[model samples]
Target: MEGARGSESGKDPQHTSLDPFQVKDPNKLAINFAYMLEEVGKVAGTWARAREDAEPDAPVSGPISDLLNTFLQVSEYWRADQTRAIEAQTRLVSTFLDIWTNSIKQLGGEDEENPVRFEPARGDKRFNDPDWERHPFFRFLKQVYLATAQWAEEMVEQPDNVDEELRQKARFYVRLVMDAVSPSNFLLTNPVVVRETLASNGENLVRGMRMLAEDLAAGRGQLRLRQTDATRFTVGKNIAATRGKVVARNDLAEIIQYEPLTPTVYKRPLLIVPPWINKFYVLDLSPERSFVRWALEHGHTVFVVSWVNPNESHAEHGWEDYASKGIDFALKTVEECTGERKANVVGYCIGGTLLTASLAAMAQEGDDRVASATFMASQVDFKYSGDLKHFATEQQIAALESAMQARGYLDGLTMANVFNMLRSRDLIWPYVVNNYMRGKEPMPFDLLYWNSDSTRMTPANHVYYLRTFYLNNDLAEGRATLRGKRLSLADIKLPVYLISAAEDHISPARSVFEGARLFGGPVEFVMGGSGHIAGIINPPHANKYEFRTGGVTGGETFEQWRATANVTPGSWWPHWQSWLAAQDEERVAARTLDPHKTYLGDAPGTYVLARD
Candidate 1:
């Protein structure tokens, strides 16, 4: 009744032309803001005291000092005041959501036993607050919350000679207020952090209620686990269902097949190898967006390795098992099924890393059936990358290795946790405050849905990868060997296409392009736009993304070519397709499957989309 009265009593019904969002009581808003700020001052005071107490033994040494100074400079975050304002809003939002959710829960929304009190934003939607704030209802609500928060902060700063207990209460209120006003809370839902935060709030009545909106958002949208009806990618009986039937499977492996669109497969055989870190279908995410499907349409006979989702049951299988099941057996089948001398191979991310390893393996064995290799955003060197490197330290990797021992495979959530940390602000925080306080669902978005599809990696495979390539730089240096093979990059004398994104942290652009020097074949290395995922999924509908390419190194190192190259925007796919066509002969026989060979039902063969 009070909120309704403020909306109606303060308004001129006929003056609809006026901005309805204009709040009548700026003083109320001002008072609330003061309270929030006072609380913030206290926080600043606490940080200052902590800084003094641990004065760092008379300041850090030269380089360390420089690093600390740099850290201190950025600590202001350039939006301190904005952050303060947010703190105030968080408090109100928490209070309002707590009251609102409880009211709704009591009122009931159809489901009596476990009623859904509020609706989340569209499955994984992000909000544009300016647009929403224009509405009288939201604007009024916002003003009240902000004003209340400001007042709370003002009290914290006052000369009340308040006890530590009172000061702590003030800080909590300030934290709540800021939590509500976060940009992430407005849109972009389905974060792992939001779920955890909401769960924690469950113990604290009001705090938990504040998180209801985000919690509900996580439960419903792209972030949430959904039981979707199988999508139709082809015709009846031969539709491109999620992961096509595993035509060939055994203890060592499974060869999964996609339902073909055309009556006959391409003239040349195509092999796909996905990394064990995640599922394989990143190439075949959906009918429209799948790169694998695109190749099939262009008349290239495509065979994707649908990896087996491994658990403790296959704990014994190490990097050797994956090589045998994922790459080795698949190659054997490619040769057996098609009488062709060689086939084209595409390796994505870690799959590409492994492909490079396999190439060395093949080179050692003198198996020259593999023709051209396409590496999509895969890195061989990790030292040059930003932020991600900080977490890849020896200690961190050791800790992670120890943790993954209990279960043979690293939990999908564990990997997700690390990834989220890399870009916490972009990935985790907003959903945190908003879900807990505002009680609104973030909207649905396809990209976020794709991100949430987490994947797990076995202890052995992950450890070998971290130790061998990422930490050791063995492959980049040409010293790495797997499966007792004298693996060397120079051995795999085949044409190669290496793709990396400029802004990618997982595989830095420089690190990715570095592979060109390792091969003795024609290397067409290109730098793309977007980070790791978006860079590879460079579809036309994709946002402002691009790549840089030119000057084929007759034979050169990664840095030399990068120095002289120029950058450009748009799809590298067409360019790659063109390059791939010139080098290869037409497929002799169409894509085919044998009922004789069964799928092994394990690793990068099928469960790529279930990574989350």
Candidate 2:
């Protein structure tokens, strides 16, 4: 083994360091392996500590135990065998070259403290590490050797799937020493090399991989969004083109109106509830991408309540105020618009949260004008909340509250940063590396562009939401009383249609499912594909999600109901549309803009088209 650890002379080290674990009597080799195990154990311990602090009530999944079992299995495999050795000579030669080139910094260079160093031929920003590109040939050599050595370790355990008798025997004799290379073994055997290597240059490798993947996938996804241009809405034409307008007046709160495409016969009125975090066009973004247009075209009357892009003036408005003024005022005006006793309502994201509160308030005081409450990406059960809670600490909340107090309103950029951090890989890192470092612009994405154009959250609204939803599970367990009335999910049970995205990191599917169960109404909970934007934009007529299944007899877990429910493969939208239509009537309602109550201006109200 000592013979293997020869001096670095830019040639294949003359000798190689044999793993001590392979020795029959070298107890020191066993100790070395133990040290590696300890290193991997520390990582697990850190994760466990974080888990306990993050969500103590949440169930510990079986996957963790399964992973640990695999780790143990690999360790045992490595300890017991090492007869047929890997042809690692080629790999060792390359690593030897790297060590020789780096030996200048190791011995002669001023950076003697640096264990790994290489001077760049030129100062290029593409390679951030200044001392990593000294010997290109040597670096390539190291990668090749490292890849093969790792491959050799892998082949020891993963016997090649060759049915040929002679070939299998030849393979076993020449390269079968890989019993030490199971998926579980890496943690036990290669902690120092893995950690030190990753720590030295992991950033560039991770960033490069992500950027490469993004670049490759961009064109394919672009085709999906751009190839489709069928409907009037798809071509970016809406009711505003035919017989409507988009008015953005500074008179009342941030409210947008998309009047009917044509006059209806019976005339049913409706209001849109958009989240404070975003400008309201999510419902009426573009013509084909606009749900608002769909509603208006179908003619049941529509008015979208876009949140006042909170400037200093609206800093004092809390959750209660949003519910009371934003929702209550909007509903009152909507009722007055068509002279309907109870107007139909639709809420998306946090908009749904406020709507649920309004319904609870109305239910408490007998105001069920919001005949049906559609919750899109809204969760009532805080018990199963996703990663958002990880960042919102009490101290952070206090800092935010104090900051918002000083500024009068939380900045749009501040809110945007938090959401971006929620999915840093997809939202921030790849584009950062590509556009900034590699000098490539981000692939144009309608959803991403919309998300990037953030809206300022009212100081009061932002603070209250964090405290109630993230800090404490108030709204989920029938505790959060927004405007004088406690809002239990059961309290707002009005033919609820709750939709959640399966791939959403902000709101996980299980969390959404649990929240939907809180509503005792005839709840039709849908699981859409993709993340937030892709999930919401899913039109039911398309072959998208295979997620919409039936509910259990009463409130039950997904596991309990998926057993008997009909397994269908497509978007849940058509099903939801059918259900909603069946609940009411199919009459083309005679909905004309109310002369006295209507804002009387344009299609996209100022609030809806607002950028931040």
Taking all chains together, each candidate's TM-score versus the true structure is 0.62, 0.61
**Candidate 1 TM-score, true structure as reference:** 0.62
Candidate 2 lDDT over residue span 248-268, tens digit each? 333326555555675663245
lDDT of each: 0.57, 0.56
lDDT of 1 by residue, 45-122 (tens): 554555555311111133233334433333343235676557656755775665455334322221235421222234
Q: Output the lDDT of residue 93, model 2.
A: 55
Number of clashing residue pairs, candidate 1: 73
lDDT for position 299 in model 2: 57
Residue runs of model 1 more than 4 Å from their true location after superposition:
1-244, 250-253, 262-266, 540-544, 552-569, 592-612
What residue runs in model 2 are displaced by over 4 Å at the alpha carbon?
Answer: 1-252, 262-267, 540-542, 552-555, 559-565, 586-589, 594-600
